[model samples]
Target: MPAPRPPTVPVLEVYSTFQGEGLRVGERQVFVRLARCDLRCAFCDTPESYPTPDNARVQRQPFGAKDEALPNPVALDVLLAAVERLDDPPGLHAAVSITGGEPLLHPHAVHALAVGARRLGLRVHVETGGHRPGAVAHVLEVVDEFSPDLKLASATGAPTPWDAHRETYHLLEGRRKALCVKAVVGAATPEAEVEAAAAFAVEHLPSAPLVLQPATPYGDGPAAPSASTLFRLHRAAGRAHPDVRVIPQVHRFLGLR
Candidate 1:
């Protein structure tokens, strides 16, 4: 019998841009934005990426050029070509970020992409919602960095999967320096939720940085957390984790996507 074909993933966009969040914030990287997400955060900026449209086209924006449209359900070779195209100067990118609506939804594709990025002498960074430890485990060996979000029910208006989040954190236990948990805090986010996320980080991945990102305004999302509220959350998180940092979405401030 012939070998089974690798999965073809629905890609939304691939571009060369600055890292927008977490520990690698402001660093230049190639972003592979995949399509589809299970959780629906109220403040989701890329709602367009959440659903796979029938006419969905992958936007390929290589460095120093306008974006070109490619067909969706792209093959791995095609995706790799897009990444290579964006990395024009060849090792200029700090990393190739595999982000998404939820990249882990296509674990095999993500793992393959990570492997390909490593071949090009680029670090592979996986950004995820951290709700699927199994999917994350599939790519752990190939990925150099993991940035998982600790979703809060109050902030996201979705069910919080504490167990899965914990499992994900524990998976990154030994990779502290290369891992970080980003918790989005809104003006209405509960203190308890922030504390729980911080406590988990302290217990499972103490050395890993815990970033409390003030939610950026999107759609009808709540207002950004006030200075006092952000400070309070920072202090609360700091109590549990010594390396807690309060950072907002820098890309939004700079008017970049």
Candidate 2:
């Protein structure tokens, strides 16, 4: 039998952009967008990542100064090399942001990458869906920051794993890891829903910052939440958790990828 094609390493879309949200807003950062996702949010901007059985249709996009997909069946050494290439000389940006369809999907790879980054004295941050507590713990062990999006009515047809997400949030509690819980506020984000998410975070991760973002105007029928609705949602979230803050996608504002 022909040698089976090597399993594609989880590729990262490495690019430079101002942080669109969270505690490090406006900071210059290298965004590493990992491929693949477990859930299909209706308003998923990167619908291409929705895990489908057919793999041939996966398209590769240009990344930063390099035009290569990440190491398929990636090894720690090869993945580290990609990180090194992202920086000129070394350490040009603020930190490495590990975002993806859901970085947790590839726990082993992410753990390897984070361990390597720490050895190089590079700061690491991870953005996730809060699905896998163990995966989140592994990434959090090496990362400086944890930005987990507590999915609040993601237009994607899949149901949110509230218990799992909540467990991850609590698991990170008491750790020095800076945690930020982000909720995508959309038309579906009712005041009660916002309060529930906020309350859960407040109860579990009281010290972690909570961020509320308006849904993007993308996807088949995406619509931006109104300013009035945002105000109410923001108020409700804040009432539940004093640390809540409203932030929009700043990268979109600056017109960077």
lDDT of 1 by residue, 91-147 (tens): 878899998899999999998999999998889999899889999778888999888
Which segments of candidate 1 are over 4 A away from where they belong? 1-6, 54-64, 174-178
The candidate maximizing TM-score is 1
At residue 77, give the lDDT of candidate 1.
83
Give each model a TM-score. 0.92, 0.85
Q: Each candidate: what lDDT?
A: 0.83, 0.72
lDDT string for model 2 (72-126, tens) is 4454565566666666546676777777788789887777777877776677888
Residue pairs in collision within model 2? 9-72, 9-73, 40-156, 41-156, 42-155, 42-156
- Residue 210, candidate 1: Cα error in Å is 0.7
